[model samples]
Target: MKLPKKIKRYCPYCKKHTEHKISLVSTGGKRSALKHGSIERAKKRGRGRGLGNKGKWGSKPAVTKWKRKTKSTKKTNILYTCQECKKSHGQKKGKRTGKVQIENKEKKK
Candidate 1:
């Protein structure tokens, strides 16, 4: 899907409509293993002392590449930056597409 480089959108900070710049919002970075309530932190604290059926904690069979199914497309999210207030906001919903492209003008053929 193709998107415009700039679009007129509502700016909450300015409390009015204004011209905004469009840009893609990339996925967040990897999570930290030492964060609070994380499984890694619990394991590090010697808390793996359960003796009964581990259920989800039990080891599972390894999955092969062919056995695992993955989606070919990804959900693309965009951000709108208010030109007047210099503030950026994101849409509530994201678009699912194979690819997203933003351009100011069409190339001359």
Candidate 2:
């Protein structure tokens, strides 16, 4: 599905309809550097105490470590800003729930 570059939605802060620009936000470069160092330290620590479970038993769940295959994006909220009111409101992505509809077919006798 193609995501909207700009979304028109209700802004509670502005109390009106607004257009929000959707873009991928990234952490500042400095923060990324800091995270890199922290991850390296964590890897080093894990190597010594078998914390990462890399070399542990391959088949056992107990030895398996949960790891994210993909890095998490910094996009936290869907931002809306009213053009007339010039006010903004942000809603977290997790707050929205999706619904799945199933169609039922009737049999003819």
**Candidate 2, clashing residue pairs?**
none
Model 2 stretches astray by more than 4 angstroms: 27-77, 94-109
* Tens digit per residue, CA lDDT, model 1, 1-109: 9998988889989999998999998866668868998666766776555686543333332345346868878888899999998999998888789989998874454
TM-score on alpha carbons, each prediction: 0.63, 0.34
TM-score result, candidate 1 = 0.63
Q: Lowest-scoring 10 consecutive residues by lDDT in candidate 2?
A: 94-103
Name model 1 segments beyond 4 Å from true: 31-63, 66-69, 106-109
Q: Which candidate is the best by lDDT?
A: 1
lDDT of each: 0.79, 0.47
Candidate number achieving the greatest TM-score relative to the actual structure? 1
List clash counts for every candidate, in order.
0, 0
1-109 in candidate 2: lDDT tens per residue? 1345556677776666676554433223555433654544555555335445544332233323545334433334444556556665555652222322222333244
